[model samples]
Target chain A: MDRNRRVSVEEVKHIAELAHIKLTEEEETLFTEQFNRILDYFSKISEVNTEGVPLTYHVLDLINVYREDEVQESLGEEEPLKNAPKREDRFFKAPRIV
Target chain B: MKTGGIEEKRALSKLYELTAIEISEKIRNQEISTEEYLYSILERIGQVEKKVHAFVTVVDEKALEKAREIDRKVRKGEKLGCLAGVAVAVKDNICTRNIRTTCSSRMLENFVPPYDATVIERLKAADAIILGKTNMDEFAMGTTTETSYFGTTHNPWDLRKVPGGSSGGSAAAVISEEATVALGSDTGGSIRCPASYCSNVGLKPTYGLVSRYGLISYANSLEQIGPLTRTVRDCALLLSVISGHDDRDSTSVNLAQKDYLSFLQDDIKKLKIGLPKEFFEEGVEEDAKGPVFEAADKFEDLGASCHEVSLPMMSYALAAYYIIAMSEASSNLARYDGLRYGYREENDEGDFDTVFSRNRRIGFGAEVRRRIILGTYALSAGYFEQYYMKALKIRTLIRRDFERVFKNVDVIIGPTMPVLPFDIGERIDDPLKLYMCDILTVPANLTGYPAISVPCGFRNGLPVGLQIIGKPFEEGTLLRVAYTFERNTDYHKYRPSL
Candidate 1:
């Protein structure tokens, strides 16, 4: 919860890589400062006595909602590909992994 | 269309001043031509849209064509839907088939949806014309429309100020008379905040009450699409048409959907109102705080019991809300890899990681990027428990805090925002300052309760929203309280002179 504890530039770059976002030099600096300040205030939650308090993953009381498995109309073959940036024989075309 | 008197003829010209119910009735009765009404709306958009950039896309041709179809239906002696050829502005985040469903992010600048959001289907079924897609904060992340990739939507009340966001465009559209009513997704005050700032009515329905079927995901667990309108009853009317069980959204509650309009009345008799003390604590200016108390007094005058309640965990609600929202956002937005849709670079070649990173960098705005990185950090191995899990645990306590207060009270009341609509560029740079504005509104979203913002009173001519949060699935009760308050006050009727 120490406000002073900061994510080093290396950590930020590492997080950006993990998040799949390439940051400009300005964004990197801005984010590094912004993230730490946000984390600092967000750390206020740590002071709460949440001992034995269960995590609320969802607000709905229902858990494991079950519905009968039934075949339904889908978006159809061409509908899904309509927005594809590139399509090759009904397949989404992408730069191949090297 | 008959306009016998000079007064009547004059009134007919400002059809934008009429409520959706009135407009629909006029269209149904042949007192007004739907096509003509659409033209006036388009003209109004052209007139004021320069000052209030509320829309990202205006489907004028499509809307006029739809209006003509409705006029023909009217001529055929067909029974009309409740909306009956009314124009409704949609928040861009809600997918409309063939209309670009940009989240006001460059990531999806040109991505036209292949399907209609469930609400859009409902609105269309009700014979409502799609006026256009309203602007919003990029991915609904910021508290102001300033983050909108297209441009900021200025407050209709004061062009120099912001229309509160991320549903600013929808609220502005309704207030500026550009649309009859608009739909906005409220994760954390996205609907109510704008309504508060714009002197309009906005409701964030109970979780699962409105189907989120085609609403582009932001924070799946937190947000719900609801209505923004000029009056509380219109909010209820819109709510009724859009709410029901939809199997398409697995989380949509299967239950008998009540007629929200049928439940509204000028009554709050015996209602127990709890004004959470924390909501009034810091950051709330007198302009924002005074009107809510005045509203509570009015409720008491009408036989409702009012008292102060404390939710000790309230201080941490904002932090917990941000953590959960950002975490969900980071996960939900991961699908925008651009292969299937959205913005992607074609000529610049690289492997998946290299390309995706580049696309996302160019795709997202600064605020969005800030959230993703912070979320990734929170969900990372070492800090996950300390931040996210702990935040979730705090969420439990926050819900319990509300539960404890709700046992003795029917609804919680407070200012929808901490301050009146501020200058356009005032706090956009300070993310924390903007987040603080939502401190009063986030508790409902955090707990999945239905909350409605009604114009209570204004400070220095600016509107203030009185937020009434009710029990889960009790939107009927929330709307009733707001309707009761609105009936007794003239605040909701205050219009900005454009």
Candidate 2:
């Protein structure tokens, strides 16, 4: 592996475009340097031996935190709709749904 | 709006050292009027919140009314609930009836829940005054408050730096005395990380110990609501009020809890505390290690035994945390269609593809959109095993590492973060670096163990936190150790002069 391999300015711009963050040209230059340094810090992790390890997704030993099957009164329809920024009667309004 | 500023700050200041339990005793004995305590803190919120930006909403009318009702009960010689008159802040992610629950995301910038969260209902029954909803990361996705559509929350200790986030605003509020305490949701160190940076105590209870029904999901399996406070005893008090079996959250544990304050008095005489070798490393700032070791030394002086333990899988904790968190996030956030709740933008330019893409492109922030896309790609049929499944396996190894250590030790101690709070814009440019910020606290989240970040000492004039990891449902032991440490050091009492 080429340890000195570096991503170019254009490549950083391409990633910024992909991420949809409207970055300035200067931001592209800054991020390219920062991203490389971050990858260097992160490369340290791959050196660890993770063989035969089971991936743990959640730590809580709880299998199920089920509540009794019962319905409670909703806070009423008007209360929620009242706070909507753009609502037309019972429903919230949006620009276009087509 | 004129809340007797000077008188209120002084009275509320007196109750700052008192736990919700102790405050209730004072309220019962008529040492302080309920209105006097409530308004005093509300006045302080008014005085400091403009600069701290700790609260997103302040329900002054509702809080004042609740105080008057409590006063009426007292005059009638009626009994009050355990947390009566204690002022608390809720993270904007937690639902509250008649209050906007934005989750700090523009997608739901104007969304309001139709009901109260289970914990909110309990707090109300106990007569706890709901000051307002505090700020958080947009959709609880980022580490810094910068990701919020509203704005970034500055660290109270040092305004230019971030309060480690997505719960940054809540932690900042408690540190600045904007509110006595606040509730924050943790998924992979959101609570503990920020609590450490802001010099407050933040607890991420074992995943199912607290209900997640009202908390907007970030990573469903990893999220837990916990308290962030200025002291360990207050954190214990907050936990006592929030922990219980909740039918609303399918995964909430029904474990019995004793009065957590009782644990503070218990002896630490023969308890074994583990210090993981992987935690103390070259990447960690040299200054942070001193306080961590100093805290360990204090524990030894308190008659507890400390040992070095190995958690080899911890090196991958941050990577695993991101993969799993993003994968779950991609799935969890899919519900926020332009149809159900929140903002909607029209795409008149093209066909179905343009329309769908445009909606998300405009609605979500750069970080939120990045995680969603990454998660969606990772969980795609072809990549699940390579990314998501493999991450889960690493997670299990991490948990097993903790279980193995816990077999011999009552608690595990370490630095909350590798470095202290960084400047606001420092890591935002590199997503990977931002994710790396949670390295020290992620293992506890992966394994479902309860961990807390307590104000232990200072470095370069800023506070440093000591993190303690406890076995499941052993919050009592965690509190006792933290309280004992706080008693030994004046770290918790050192409020920022700002």
Candidate 3:
């Protein structure tokens, strides 16, 4: 929330990790500079007093949209799994977690 | 009616220039076969596509085959759908079964969806031939089409200038007569900006009016698949085909289905139009303002009331839009890991984090990566309240501003874009300057209002669009107003001279 706080390179690296994006050293520096400028522009939002304004998540005022929980045909396992980089019998293969 | 005469050739050439409604009428009356119509459109594409670069993938053979199928049905005296045999260029973000639906990004270059989007299903049901997937900004993330990974789509009016984006290719295709009509997604003016630049009629329907089942998510809340065509009636016809209830998309509203083309009455009598004063202030180009104000005068001439109104919160709309869009994008794009559908690293030797990060780094373009990172920062632990939370609050205020104004005015009118199309690569490197182009257009997205951008007139040899925004789900009024304006002016009739 620091008004004039600049995004340090270390913070940029941390954020890239959180976003699952691997940045080269060059990208790190570029992002730091761009972030400072873009965030500085966004900081102007603090000037407005939104004291009692409620946050709007969706524009439509519809509440939870419910549907019948009946079974319907889906893209059988093979069609969707066809695009996976690595797949086992019928599932996507990923590296071991442990 | 000589077969090889010059007059016959000219008459046949004019067939490709007709609007979708006219084409449908001709087809119904047996005046033109679908095969003949497709041939003329394909000939026009051959003539102008090299200069425009509007399509990422042109399904020429498949389209011809589909046209032939429709022609056979016509010969059998069967009932035809509303848009039978109409050619439509779809923005690449919407998934098409077995077609390479890249969002003009390298990540999904080889990925093809197994199923069609709800909109595509509806289009197919209506017998509209899928022309091809059109070019777009990478992941629909940038203002100008310059950020497209497949290469920039040139504005048909001037090949050197950019077609405003992220739906630039759709706009350019309709302008250059490459397609009879096209579909484009608008999140913060993607459809309207390019429509303004390419001199076409583009509609961004109310948030949930059209199903988003097959659209590749950019900002889930702000984006909607809409139509871009050379005329307002064509826009409405396409909208009617693709809109309505779809349980597949949980957000799609089940509003009573209405024939949008029926709303295209050329009457704006007693229609109240509000002109936001801030949209005409300092940064807007004088040339762009001239056409908009003149269009408003024309509306008054047609017996409608035009008055200046103030929306003070509009100044903050641009910043709020970026924050909310980026935050949503960050979350939506997290599915692009090496393990799943999209681009994957070849080595495959690293652990999960390493593979995921490397895939994202290599797959996504620079702008997409930058927005994702900025969004991640905005939603991070210490900064969430400062950036994302405040942005949501401002969004509420902006929506309230529109609600309050619409109490007195049936619709609001302004310039779709503050300036004309710029030279390609003019503002690509400067991200802030590029973001400023959406200043006037984002308020509609923020509030999820239905808005249309229609070509008003030319400025400095380029086209200017006058935007008409209606109350939420009031697309009928918006289309009617735009249709009336088209009747009064010849701006929409001016071809790009490609």
Candidate 4:
């Protein structure tokens, strides 16, 4: 964690890319400033040492929940795929990978 | 729109203003037919929807049909569910089969759920009429309803002020008598903030107490679907209907359904109440701060001892809440690539990454995209240890803070919002300042505790919400306190004059 860390314009673009969100030039600059300000506010947390405190990803004490694998009723393509942008033969049509 | 004389107002009060209990009894006793009641509520929505903009979609025809169905059941002398014929306004993020669940985002503008959410199914079984889906912040991302893609929901109390987000529409609908009750999900104060702003009772149940199977995920770990109602008793009735075990949601608690209404008794003789000094220490507006202490004095009058307690970790809760919530949001929202469902890209000539990114960019609003990018950066290489993990560690500290205090106090009390509802566009631009408004409500979400907001008093003619945070899984106690408050005080009886 760099104390003087600031997100550059390219880094914001890269982050948007990683998140699969395309950003306009205006959003890039605006987000960079907001991010720097927010991150600086957030940096105050690093000062406190939580040496042995375990992180809580989920507040509830949940365990590996399992059920008997059995045949069950399922939603057919007609309803589940109703909102598909493009479909063919009860299947979602997607952009070409290559 | 048909109010002229005070006697006519008295006649119409039997329609939309009835609580779940009173309305259901009226239907059962033939004092009012369900169809007639539904028409009255629909007419109420018609009269107020133009001014408040609470609902994204109103199911007038379907609601009438359901109401008639309940009427037929009543005629048959069939057993009725507890909330039979009660009209419920649902937040658009919850799935309603054959109904659009937009989440107030262009991304899900036309998407409808293929099946009902578990809560929706339970509501149907309870014979509660689904009045409509209310508007919300895009993907439940912001503090004010102004981020809604449809439009902002105005506070019925003051049309100039905002109904708080992201459950703004739900709260507005409940307070305006547009609907008897509403279902809302809270991630970081979404339910309670709007309830505070609009002067309704809102509860965020313990994590996993209510099933979240049909809820559109914002922050999967932090959010819970809860009720916003005109009275605490109505809140309990709705909560009883929607909560319980559901195999559809693995996280749903494995306990038998408890009737929260049974917990409402007019007594809190020796309950210990902690007033976290930190909640009132900074940034709280004068009018808002005054009512909480006044409410504390009322609690003392009820024989509950009020003492100042410290939860210093509250200072870091808002920051940690945003980080964890945004991180989960970035991951949970990655599934909306537009091919399978949701807003579609017309020009489909690009490769997979290009199409996905393009759709997401065009689909999400500015705040949604901003949080997603920040989340992606926090979880990215070299920064995970710095931001996301540190936030989680602070989460433990905050939880410990609550645990340490709850051992001494039965419930923690504070103002639900640091200020009254601001003017609609007042703080939307300054995101940090807007986030500050949630400072009082997010600690419960951060700690997976059950909390309720009941109308305490008014601040400068606007209603104030006094928040009571109880121990996890003790929704019964939370209801007891709020119901007692509502019974003794006249605050909950105040209406917005919509």
TM-score of each: 0.97, 0.88, 0.97, 0.97
lDDT of 1 by residue, B418-496 (tens): 8889998999888998888889888898899899898888677788888899998888888888888878888877788
Model 4, residue B269: distance off in Å is: 0.6
lDDT of 3 by residue, B1-498 (tens): 225678766777777888899888888789988877887888898898889999999999999999989988888999999998999999999999988898999899888899999999999999899999999999999878888889999998889999999999999999898899999999999999999999999999999999999999999999999999999999989999999999988889989999988998889999999999998998899988999999989999999999889999999999999999999999999988867688887777668888888999999999999999999988999999999999999999998889899999999999999989999989998898999999998999999999999999887789999999999899999999999999889998899888
In model 1, the clashing pairs are none
lDDT, residue B98, candidate 3? 86
Model 4 stretches with alpha carbons more than 4 Å out: A1-5, B1-13
lDDT of each: 0.89, 0.79, 0.92, 0.90
Minimal lDDT window, size 10, model 2 chain B: B347-356
TM-score of the candidate numbered 2?
Answer: 0.88
Residue A72, model 2: lDDT of 73
* Tens-place lDDT digits, model 3, residues A4-49: 6578889999999999999999989888888898999998999999
lDDT tens per residue, model 1, A19-41: 99998887777777777788788
TM-score of chain A by itself in each prediction: 0.87, 0.59, 0.90, 0.89
Which 10 residues in a row give candidate 3 chain B its minimum summed lDDT?
A: B1-10
Better of 2 and 3 by TM-score: 3
Taking the candidates one at a time, how many backbone clashes does each contain? 0, 16, 0, 0
Q: Is the docking of candidate 3 incorrect, acceptable, medium or high quality?
A: medium
lDDT of 4 by residue, A48-84 (tens): 7899999999887887777789999998658877899
Q: Write the per-residue lDDT of candidate 2 for residues B1-498, one digit (tens) a residue.
A: 234577765656555445566667788877877777776677677667777787778888888898888878888989898888887889999998878898888888878788889889878887898888888888888888889888988888888898889899899988887777899999988999899999999999987888888888889888899999887878888888889887778787777755787788646889899999888986888777789999898899989999999997888888777778888988887766555566656444554334445555567887887677566655766657766787787777777788788999999999998898889899887787788788888887888889999988888878888999999888999999888888888888788876
Local accuracy of candidate 2 as per-residue lDDT tens digits, A33-53: 655654454344445556777
The global Cα lDDT (0 to 1) of model 2 is 0.79
